[model samples]
Target chain A: MTTETTDAELTIWRDGRFQADEWTRAAEDEAVADGPAILPLERFLAERDALVSRNAPLGVSVEPNEAIEELAPHLDRVALVTLNFPKYSDGRSSSSARLLRERYGYVGEIRAVGDVLIDQMPLMRRCGFDSFAVTNPVTRKQLAEGQWPDVPFYYQPTGSTQQAEVPAGTRPWARKPS
Target chain B: MYRYDEFDHGFVAARVDQFRDQVARRLTGELTEDQFKPLRLMNGVYLQLHAYMLRIAIPYGTLSSKQLRMLGHIARTYDRGYGHFTTRQNLQFNWPALKDIPAVLDDLAKVEMHALQTSGNCIRNVTTDHFAGAAADEITDPRPYAEILRQWSSIHPEFSFLPRKFKIAVTGAPKDRAAIQVHDIGLELKRGPDGGIGFAVYVGGGQGRTPMIAHKVRDYLAEEDLLAYVEAIMRVYNLHGRRDNKYKARIKILVHETGAEEITRQIEAEFVEVRKTELLRLPDSEIERITAYFAPPVLAEKPARSSAFEAAKADSAAFADFATYNVTPHKAAGYGVVTISLKPIGGIPGDATDVQMEAIADLADAYSQGEIRVSHEQNLVLPHVALDDMPALYAKLAEHGLATGNAGLVTDIIACPGLDYCALANARSIPLAQDLSNRFGSPERQKEIGELKIKISGCINACGHHHVGHIGLLGVDRRGEEVYQITLGGSGDETASVGTLVGPGFKTEEVVDAVETVVDTYLKLREGPDEPFLAAVRRLGQQPFKEALYGTA
Candidate 1:
């Protein structure tokens, strides 16, 4: 439910910087695009075999609350998994991304799309999102200007910031430098 | 009592910088109100009826004299001259502008305090027994665990966006003064069969429109497993709790819909997987690190009896009443825990002025080891005062109008800042509390009906904790007129139960009489003077009180 549904360019940011986006979002009523493109989960599930056989860097977009178990078995084929925030307040996809990473062991790039604001970058990243579809102009400028949300330390070990070793005596179990 | 380390200091300073930026963006209209709401709430700012209100955390109800004085400074500078102590043992300033919040936070951070996570859907300020390190009956100090939780839950990623706000309470003593059973997550500190520290965990207990007592999930979880077990529970709740309806979004509803056994099974399975991560198994060194911050202050031992206290009581009846009502036994010899009551006859329950706060700070420095605690019951406790200082402390407190001599009596009511200040309130509650206090203003009458708790909430949200009050009053609007609904027999102690609704409703003008009538009925029906109001209600049940309220044929 983002109010910003204006026609705008969608830029994909990944691996420390924004690059030319190879993935195109296919319009629902139109015929499928030729190159690397993402389809809704239902279309992907319905045309699984055909799409898998002719795959050219295929991806699948999921609703925020969609059951991730349905997409778990198809993890081997997809090059990217797109999770939606819908709005900044709706956070079911964080759970979905974690399930994909920790439960299904999906290694493909998981990109956060829709209502991807600047403030949620760190949380969205820590919840296993490796890429983001930058449509929000403010967030785009924020990302472009090299400003980012980086704290001195973190409390929990999840996603990218897991504490792999025991910390020192001064601050153990906590104070994992980020 | 925990002091900020270098890391903590840096984090707080960084957070203040971030919030200041957010405030600048908001004022410049770069961030919409909807976008700014959660951000402001995360920093403990709320847009109330007239202006923004700020809530500062008093972690686990523990406070130092310097920190208390800082709060007074904030009250005097940024807010109305007064601050209200909330049921969560936090402080709420009724008036703080949105622009002023960043500056307010700066002042707070200087004192090693911040308003972080005091509001919003994050794990709120970790509350525990106010008598944590000083109570005579405490098995271990719960503040260390509470501090551990405060750190772990701060800026938490997954849980920061919970379905609904979560509350957790911990208690070291078995008496349950922290109201553990009513929290979303309750941890009772205890020793296991191996004589090692552990916790008895309870989950999904809360009071709101639908109140349910928490179910015990684990009888004994090792102290090392505290964070891991709690993380498992939070994950289970975050994934499965219903999000379709806001009212049913609490973990309590999830625990209710999914049977306790099934929820326990899910949590246990999650715990097995989460413990594999090894990041949260609290090391003994970490526990010791936090526990050292709460080490009790050294006190010189004295005789078992203080002749000065005895002689002062003999000299003045007022001192005798104050000694009898406000003082409780301390774990240290010849020391007493003094409760500085905020409630006065026909006055606000928890409102303390900046002057009064500074006075408490001065007195704490003078008499109580420079340590103070904010009780959940809306009173302040001086944790370690010598018995011989009773008269002097009472006199100084009296000069500042802080000595009310009603710790657990009728006048010591817990009333939320209802329609007077809160935008969510449906009707007025503080007015009714004022009226009731005046009606029972007589010390003789209050002493006769000893240890009665009257909690009032302005709405069904139950911010006043009326559901756990021995006598609860809930305000409702009936056809544009404010009225009240009464509930009885609720107890928040170890024997926790939601109060049963008594029948009918009373007008605003009549609520005071209705409460008096209920009290008088209890006085008549009691087995004797020794039987407290709650005990009589439990023995006789709601039928007798119901008959007395509406009258029987």
Candidate 2:
């Protein structure tokens, strides 16, 4: 749950806890190498050939207002997509995550970054976000302790891997009358 | 009435526990007030003028006698011995401690009720025609579909943090008693050309500071695509709905700013993608399962002409008035729908004491097949009273001060909780409604006026739905004084229209006279008493009414 002190360094959280930091988020005009790197969508598009030739894990950071369809053709080459929430109230990224998983059929990890509050984690998880890059220490502690309030069952079916399958005989409304 | 299945029961119970933990966190100072406000609002708890107001949703206004009795119990145990029924077919307890909310929610959960999504930026409680199953003109019962929407929208992953609060209303009948045209999304059940049921979807309709009637987004959408289509609509709004301005953040503003044609285009595009997924599709079996819960109760047909009913009506003029004004024709042959008026002379429009609620519950159990409905007009309906038992029911209602015989009369006003209880109100709507009720309290005078709807709101938020009122009054604060602004020619039915403002506003003391002036003008302008006030206003524009209100032009 504790962060290493480094400027502009990114830590990846996967499967429930923080994993090792390996990918370096590339700055604009940074040279590509045969190593893990996360690039902005614009920079990724500019250096798509070099990144593809590198033959390593690649990720792209997407802005809230960016069209998700622009990354549809590149989904096969990317391993992760980071959806940025400028603020918690701006919900465009949630829709973007759904489009990526359900529409584009992208199987890579989708992480929510920036102002990632603990309360919205459940919702983010429901919308195909597998991980959250939380910046707040208290929220990070809560997430690590599994103390965030979570509702196990859901009313709507979201195409998320973490979604619990609605049990049979529970949805009696889906049964034929005798 | 739709009963809760095991899944529905478990879902509500889990929601209660989740909210209890959230409340505990707020109390322990783990969550700040800003963080706790949305959670509390989602659970229907509000910090009002004096104390916490807990709004309990009576879904689509349908309530079992047992549930009503529980509401009565809660009123007596945790709050003042009274509750106010709102225009949205919910009940609000105006006085409660914040610490008691979890217990209140727990009690409601025991009765298969919870306040989840009753407030919040998410989808709210889905409302439908109060007389859905009993109304003779209905094409099909709408409660099933409303219940479906309620389930789909509850804790929806993507739409929870919407631009603003969204409301959905459904109606199966063509007559539109549910005020479908003024909701964020209005669904009208219609029979397609192939004899299959579908919905005529309307989007972007709302009544607030800026009132706009919803436009038809889909002429005919298949029944199986209900959730998918709604999800498409929500997606479009969630992505592009304005967030910078709270006042202009409603879906109505979105639909208005983005041309309805363009919004429809985007929704259709979104629907193409959404309908392909199994995520939101309504399967035939699911529809059948939900529909089964709303199957109408069997009642043996009785003679159309009840000699006891006729004799009782002939014997008592008061009973005749109640039969004429308070009873509506039921779909069942020998039964009638009875509206028990909560608006007595000089009384608050929708407040009922614990005793009255308990009495109504008893009456519902005895005569109405244990079913009671809360109408948007702030009255309760006993949906299955036998014609032969009208006299006995009327007698009991009279004893409980519920038989006012003013169902559609001028005295049956729909008003909001203005400055009296609401924190957002600018003036007091209850006092104005009381004054108007007292002035038009005479039964004979009310009968003569005949079906003049006077809706008053204390602010521009339009919780009172003043824009659709036949004669609307809006309360505004002006330079430390409360002034009332009047609107004319509003109706909330099939031909829904926002009322037009009638010149300047009136001072508090002068507002009642101004209302009287408008009513007198309508009386003078009408061809006869048979033509109701709304019809007269529609036929003859607002010019004459304006002249009468502010003198000749």
Candidate 3:
């Protein structure tokens, strides 16, 4: 119900990079960073054996539930590909992060890097993401409004996304036998 | 008949407000067409050939006179004075402006109605037999269960975004009036050996680019497990059903590829997990609470048959023909169920003008218990009318142009809007249906050829249920000229199958005569009056009919 209307007013950042309104060839440019670099999932998969040989943690964002058992062992330290909201309706990336965490059991840092509508932060946490990179700039009041939608951490197993075990008497779908 | 309590009414009002906001956003350019499309579709608004079509859910095809009167108001104020009933026991309005939608929804909300999940890839309005509470063969009314499903599935968070739209139909009677077999999920209610009511579940049956019969997922799922079992099946489909191709996304294809056994095994595993939770148990008290809302109306003790009504039927051939064709047996011995044919001879099958709707609503209030139900066959029913009041009711209906003496006869066709309103249609179905009705307009002639189902579709989508008609007419455009392909011997009842195509296609002008030829041949070859056209065609095949039509076998 907040009255702020412009997308430029809210600013967010993820993975040590500040999201900006302007774009350049560098944004689209592919280069190997000297220290560490984030990459798309397909590119990482293309160079997986080489990266695995070199033991480098290549970062990439994935679609929802796009993981296989084979990708589990190598993704422990790699930076995972997350959403930049090409479209809010496109939920492929949310599924991607969940699959990586639960199905592959990846212990790496999960980041919400792009077009991460600040309102969805709690949902992001519930879906197993530990960190968020909010890109929309907001006033202090706007930031407060965009902080979180609801309580985080769903206690039950759902879809391809797994969850942390629930505390006693907290999880409602779970009931003791009569 | 399920009355909305305060909670239900508040929820519906909230939904209307949410949609009003969505519409505002779209109008103000805050949302684009792509973003709005899914939102609108979820609300049952579709952008059709000329204008937007709003499909209102007539849950289990049951309606009160007040609801019909509201629809009549919509027809007059918001639309072009009519509403078209679809095969799914829902009504579709062809023209409503984008801006006026919110107002229309607001008006509908006043009557405990909303168009939520009427379209879109989620669980749709759960349909059941139109004669749900009143059918003679029913073990129990299916509407209460359908209402429960409708409540459970409406805007459910986990199930809102599915790979494709889903349809479910349930039937309580042994005779399947709901056409359960051709739906995405078909449930036949049954009494188990333990004397508990349960369901036999069928999944994957659908009609579209690929027509499929549903596979049995479970034979007897207890009533308490119904919601959970349904949830399990949907979860499996949501997680594993293909999304890469629209045509292969239906549960039918998933069942075919993974095999029904594997699908059922997966669902059973999920069902076990779901049952371990507390949400699956719908208490008997809760079931009874829902059922109480649909309790039968109070009946005044009266004679089972009216000698005055019988004399009137015997006095006039028209009245007798109307009574013979339109009236059906009531569950209560003293009353009768009347089907007021919306499809008058040579008129569109399911189109009713605003005035006609008002007239029927008045009749419903005066005679029946202020209730009206829409049949899947696109006819309206006054489910419980005293036998003594039928003649007066018929007289009233006749004045409004709704007293056609053809309910299940040759002229009582199930037809689609076709090229007249649908952009996807290759030919016109309503005109063809009108032509056929005109050819066989005589009441005696229609009575002689009794209990035949003739379904016509403008295209292969089978909106008119042409695939399951005893005599099916499919409109196809051959080299840019409209021609129809005829199929025979199909049935949509407990024994359901796609009809086989017969001979070559006929031109638009010749289709009606061709249908006549087929019916005339059936009349000549049938062994007795009990054998219907479907049975006769099945027993004798299409060889003799083809010979009679084309001069050689």
Top model number, DockQ: 2
Compared with the true structure, what per-residue lDDT tens digits does model 2 show for residues B1-553? 6777776777788778888988898889988988888789878999998998999988889999999999999999999999999999999999988888999998998889988887878898888898889987999999999989887787777888888999999999999999999999999999999999999999999999999999999999999899999999999998889988999999999999999999999999999999887667777888898899888877768887788899999999888889999998889888898999999888999999999999999999999889999999899999988899999999999998998999878889989999988899998899999999999899888888988889999999989989999989999999989899999888888899999998899999999999999888888889999999999998999889888877776
Interface RMSD values for all candidates: 2.3, 2.4, 7.3
Ranking, lDDT, top scorer first: 1, 2, 3
* lDDT accuracy of residue B348 in candidate 3: 93
For candidate 3, lDDT tens digit of each residue in B1-553?
Answer: 7887655676677667767877997899976786678668878999888999999988889888999999999999999999988788888999999899999998888888889889877789888888888777888988888988887776554555566888999999989988898888999999998999999999988866577778888899999888879888887786677777877887888888999899999999978866766455677877888888899889788777788779889888888887787887878877888898877888999988889888999999999999999988999989988888888988889889988889888898999989999989999999999989989988778888988999999998888888888999999989999999998987778888778888899999888888888988898999999998888998999799889877873
Which segments of candidate 1 are over 4 A away from where they belong?
A: A1-7, A16-20, A24-34, A37-55, A67-74, A102-105, A159-169, A175-178
Q: Residues A64-143, candidate 2: write the lDDT tens digits.
A: 77888899999999998999988877788999998898888888889899978877787888789987786777676676
Instruction: List runs of model 2 lying over 4 Å from the truth.
Output: A1-13, A28-35, A46-51, A162-167, A170-178
Give per-model CA RMSD. 3.4, 2.9, 6.4
Better of 1 and 3 by TM-score: 1
A52-130 per-residue lDDT for model 3 (tens digits): 5444445666544454333556676575544444533333455445556645667666766655554345445545665
TM-score of 2: 0.96
Each model's total of backbone clashes: 0, 0, 17
Q: What interface RMSD, in Å and to 1 decimal, does model 2 have?
A: 2.4
